[model samples]
Target: MEYAQLGRTGLKVSRLCLGTMNFGPQTTEEDSHAIMDRAHELGLNFFDTADVYGWQKGEGITENIIGRWFAKGGGRRERTVIATKLYGDMGDWPNDGRLSALNIRRAADASLRRLQTDHIDVYQAHHIDRNTPFEEFWEAMEVLRQQGKILYVGSSNFAGWHIAKAQETARRRNFLGLVSEQSPYNLLVRAPELEVIPACEDYGIGLIPWSPLFGGLLGGVLRKLDRVRSAASDLVTELERNREKIERYEAFCDELGEQPSHVALAWLLHRPAVTAPIIGPRTVEQLDGTIRALEVKLDDKALARLDEIFPGHRPAPEDYAW
Candidate 1:
């Protein structure tokens, strides 16, 4: 696996981050542990998880699993760089889930307790909370940094303007700004390139792309509805709207003599702005396929062909009106 600097933080992480969103619900603890072990053995040193991962009812099981793994003397804990998120609603409490100082403190303590770790490598805001002012939210994150609870801060699913606003807010307040961004980017989704990528590039922020395989739509199995249903949610509905686009992407993949997943991931890695792509797998077999994508280099011709097919255009659904 290749390694790269995580934005301006001077932290080196694996080019492919192992994401644990499926740990508790879709994947067993044993399977999740085994996957972590395998990833470590293969030189992957970065792991990503969030408090809101897993089934809707089991909101924090993914972090709990990692905590257990660490408590069990898993030497991997010290060597691996762990990243987790906050700011997702976990219950019905009105103020329980915002990025206010109170919520940040509460969430950080809970995450630290669950991960069995004193500090998180990268603490991210899962999404922008429009209800909270940028200064207010960033100030809360700064408190965590000062307390040594988190080393770096990042944002996820945020648009270019939001990122710029956060950076500006930090500058005026003399606080630590976001060092990275986590967004969905893949062959089927080039929306980030239109704005987010440029912003990150200009600001020297790292870009960590989630769903680099387009939620398995680029994993070849998505060609069939039954196979897709077994892997992801909203697949059936998504296919209904973009069936023709899916077939065309598959044909483009075939023309390049690459598996759909490989092409999808390779395309993301080919971009200069992307630091890493988070890979989530319910089983070892699934991970094996995704891991191989790092080796499938895409030349200019192939990339151009892909751009011709997908046009690097943002789908209407992915646009941020704000």
Candidate 2:
């Protein structure tokens, strides 16, 4: 796997990051460990997880799983660049979950305890907390950096304007600005290209795309109408409900002569602004399929073909907000 620098942080990460949201929910601990082992074997050093994942009851279950992996003492803990997020509703209290100074400190302590680590490689805000002032959030993040709790800061699910405002706030306060952005970008979902990609390019922030396969729509498993219908019924009903989008994705996959996942990921890898595509899979087979995406290089003609298939379709009016 090829490695790239994660924004201005000077940390080298693989082109694909292993995402662990499925752990403890759809995946067993043993399978999660096995996937991590395989990722390491494949030279993937970057792992991304959020505290909100792994359980429907509460937060930090994913981090807890990672803690168990570290406790196993198989040399895996020392070899990976672990990234996690905060600022989601963890059921603490109403308005207790925004990016306030208190929440940032509390979240970092909880994350450290759960991950069994002294420092996080990359710390991120799970979403844009409009309720909190940008200065307060940036200042709190700066304190975390100074305290050695987090090595670098990033933002997820943020728009271009949000990123710009945060950078300006950090600059005025002499705090650390965001170094990377994690957004939804893939062959099927290129909406970020309209704003987020240009902002990252202009400001030197790295981009990590989540749902690079459009929640398995680009994984070739949904090619047949029946299979698509069946898979749609399982989970994440929103993706399944969008019939037009699913059809477009399948047509693009067919034109690429590659699996839907490979086509989806290769498109992201071809972009200069993208640092990595976060890959989340429930099973080893699915993970292997995502890994193969690194090998499917797309040329100019191939890209044109893909563009022709999917075109420049944006999310409908109702699906705009994060």
Candidate 3:
């Protein structure tokens, strides 16, 4: 796997990050361990999870599964750069989620225990906390950093000005600020190109795009639909909305003799501010499929064709100006 620096930080991470949201819900514990083992063997060192994952059954189920894998004692913990998020409702109480100082402290301790690790490589806020001030949030994170509980901090689903506000607050308080931003970005979702990408570029923050395949729309969804005959309603709606574009895109991939998923991932790798795109594969075969994307680099002509199909927005001021 190719490695890149995470934003301006000196730390190196794989171009593709393994996301573990499906660990407990969609995949069993033994299979999850095997998938992680394969990822480690293939040099996919970065893994991302959230305290609120394992959606239906309960929160932290996925993290508990990861903890068991780490407990097996195969140097798995040492070989990976683990990232996890907070800011979800883990309990009935109001303070159970969000970025309040007390909640941040509580959440970090809970995450460390669940992951069976003493420290997190990157601890992130899952979303913006409009209730808590940035000062309060960073102060808590600073404490975690000083105690060596977390090495770096990051954000998810934040707007362009949110990043700017976060970095400015960190600067004023002499803190390291956000090192990365995770957002939904794919061939079907070019909204981040409007401002978030530009803001991250200006602030030296790396982009770790989630949902890079648009819920399998760019992953040969039409072909799969031809066989399975059922899909999530939202995914079905998105596919219907972009049917024409997807037809052209699939034809483009057909000509290249590459899977649509591979081309989608390769396209994200070519974006300027992107450090990694999160890939959440449920099975070992699916996990292995992600590796092929690393080889399918698109040339200028291919890129131009994709641009014509997707037509991303221009950077902020200009996009809004006229």
Best by lDDT: 3
Backbone Cα, N, C clashes tallied per candidate:
0, 2, 0
Please give the lDDT score for candidate 2: 0.82
* Deviating ranges (above 4 Å) for candidate 3: 56-58
**Which residue pairs come into collision in candidate 2?**
218-260, 218-261
Error of 2 at 303 (Å): 0.6
Better of 1 and 2 by lDDT: 1
lDDT leaderboard ranking: 3, 1, 2
lDDT of 2 by residue, 87-169 (tens): 77777576457688888888888889999988888999999988889988878877888888898889999998999998888
User: How well does candidate 3 score on lDDT at residue 217?
Assistant: 88
How does candidate 3 fare on TM-score?
0.98
Q: Per-residue alpha-carbon lDDT of model 1 for 1-322, expressed as tens digits?
A: 7999998778999999999998998899999988888888888999999888864732588999998888877587898899999888766786678687788888889899989999999999999888889878877887888889999999999998898999999989987698899998886677787678878988889999998877667777555667767645686677666777778888877887888888788888888678889998899887777887888988888887777877775423455443
Local error of candidate 3 at residue 11 (angstroms): 0.8
The superposed Cα distance between candidate 1 and the true structure at residue 270, in angstroms, equals: 0.7
User: What TM-score would you give candidate 1 relative to the actual structure?
Assistant: 0.91
Q: What local lDDT does model 2 show for residue 31?
A: 92
Work out the TM-score per prediction.
Answer: 0.91, 0.89, 0.98
